[model samples]
Target: MLAALWAAEGPLGAAAVQSALGGRLARTTVTTILTRLHDKGAVSRSRVGRGFAYSPLQDSAGLTARRMRNELDKQHDRGTALARFVSQLTREDEELLRNLLGGAGDGVRGGPQPGVGDGPRP
Candidate 1:
């Protein structure tokens, strides 16, 4: 649904979205889904006659990042959850994550150090 809106040249009405989806979903379902997406801030919408036309507010990467952030926020112990997440990452992924957080290269303090040791982390 979001993909359809994102690929559209402009905001699309629910019927258009439904058609873009190859008509696999009913029009009412498309409208309901769009309404839910609008409620969740995943899409922006404006009135089009009696209904609304919607467009994706986030690109694919932005959507994925938002979902990751949302999932992180749901944890009771964020520090532990983050640590566990980091611990499971591959070295290349760890480096990418570190660089993305405003650092470059290796041996950086507070960066994820994958497969460093069997000993406890600093």
Candidate 2:
């Protein structure tokens, strides 16, 4: 459902989304899923007639990153969790991360960020 919305050029009504899915899911089911996504902050909705038009708030990669951050936030030992996660990353991913971090080294680009309460995390 989210993929369907993400693929849309603009916000879509439930009926449109259902049609996009080839009607495999009922309109109510699509509406329900969109509602759930809206509640989860994964999508945004606008009043459309008596119903609403929905659009994905983030692309797939961004959604995955948000989920990862949420999961990390839930951990009691975030440092340990992040360490383990980085430790398990494939070489390519590890290198990519290092490059990203390196690029962010300068404050203007998204350098090392201040901790919570101090400022935003890059």
Candidate 3:
């Protein structure tokens, strides 16, 4: 899985990854997951002998956000879907989202951001 690739010091072959993960997953399953990750642009792969070696293209949070966007793309009403998703956020999360969106252009300053370090805005 992605976690396996993330933990690897460098690109890893599917067999090595499967073995490292306690061999709970078949090598073929690991290959399939790696292929999927490659297709998702979360990882890059290259031929290594008869098999492929894979390496992560992004950090965990970037990979997770890409997955979230892919899931969002499948919804019929994206606005409703996003609204419902946002509605479920805790106050702290909401504040974080608001600040992140608001600070899109201006680089984050030295001051503590809302809901960060200082807790949610009252």
Clashes (backbone N, CA, C under 3 Å), per candidate, total 0, 1, 0
Worst 10 residues of 1 by lDDT: 109-118
Looking at model 3, residue 10 earns an lDDT score of 95
Off by over 4 Å in 2: 107-122
- Candidate No. with top lDDT: 1
> Could you estimate the TM-score for every candidate?
0.80, 0.85, 0.78
* By TM-score: ranked, best first: 2, 1, 3
Per-residue lDDT over 1-122 for candidate 2, one digit per residue giving the tens place of the 0 to 100 score: 98899889999999999999999998998999999999999999999899999999988878988999999999999999999998887665665667667776564442233331242223
- Write the residue-wise lDDT of candidate 3 on 1-122 in tens digits: 77888898999999989988999998888889889878868889999999889998988877678788899999999999999999877777777777877886788632346436345435
Winner on TM-score between 1 and 2 is: 2
lDDT, candidate 2, at 14: 96
The C-alpha lDDT values of all candidates are 0.85, 0.84, 0.83
Could you say which candidate leads in TM-score? 2
Q: Which stretches of candidate 3 lie over 4 Å from their true place?
A: 107-122
- Candidate 1 TM-score over all chains jointly: 0.80
Candidate 1's displacement at residue 7, Å, is 0.9
